[model samples]
Target: MELFSDDFTDGNALAGPLREIFAVDMTTATGRCAGCGDEGPVAGMKVYAHAPGLVARCPSCQQVLMRLVRGPSSAWLDLRGTMSLRIPMPAE
Candidate 1:
């Protein structure tokens, strides 16, 4: 049996949900995968939204890069799978 479903959307799908949590566009940010050491734009990751929340995985090694769950009044974000994320910010 398959442990994971093949149905999923691209990282671009995360833009709306993430915008609620971050001030910047997270899809354009770059992240380093803890499992594979691969660094790339979050937009290049694969996003699965069928679960209770959103799960984003590395495109190179398929390692989970992040997870975001939204509640009625709050939101939870997990970045355990990513070593680090470089989010762009506008300079004043």
Candidate 2:
């Protein structure tokens, strides 16, 4: 059960690891919210780092957008909460 209402932070908390996953800056990446269909940058999401894993939630409807769990051997990623993530490719 959740006991604290102030346990949430901004998406800057996940910037490091998320950057490694996508190999790019996620702040510029657009994410489509599955809950309310809101489309915006991932950096706009609300992040909860109080748990073992980091959860990114939509700022519009407070819906989860992403969940990341780092383990000794591997890392787990859950993007089911987001309908789509648009990553921009650099020009060659």
Candidate 3:
């Protein structure tokens, strides 16, 4: 599914639509933060995922952040605005 939008905010908002497109368990999805250089849960952070992967939000600066981003890994959305970091799924 397409990622990000002028109207998008939280990851939960895209979870349903994203799952419909990727057909993956968007509920258990997780990723690191490319903005704060931290890795953790992706719950409260605004997020979005596409063919590239997931884009978790950084809860520190509210930037459209990402994580573990190297070659073909999942992307992330920066959620530093509402919180420090979020993990929708339970810690592993």
Top candidate by TM-score? 1
Candidate 2 Cα lDDT to native: 0.86
TM-scores of all predicted structures:
0.89, 0.87, 0.42
Ranking by TM-score: 1, 2, 3
Model 3, TM vs. native: 0.42
The candidate, 1 or 2, that scores higher on TM-score is 1
Alpha-carbon runs more than 4 Å astray in model 2: 1-4
Q: Write the per-residue lDDT of candidate 2 for residues 1-92, one digit (tens) a residue.
A: 76465668887788898876777888778999999999988777899988999999998888889999998888899999999989887988
Considering summed lDDT, which 10 consecutive residues are worst modelled in model 3?
A: 78-87
**Per-residue CA lDDT of candidate 1, range 6-79, in tens?**
88789998899999888889999999999999999988889999999999999888899999999999899999
Q: Across residues 1-92, which tens digit of lDDT does each residue of candidate 3 receive? A: 75465433565655554455455555445555555565444445555544354455565555665332324444443234323323354467
Candidate 1 ranges with C-alpha deviation above 4 Å? 1-5
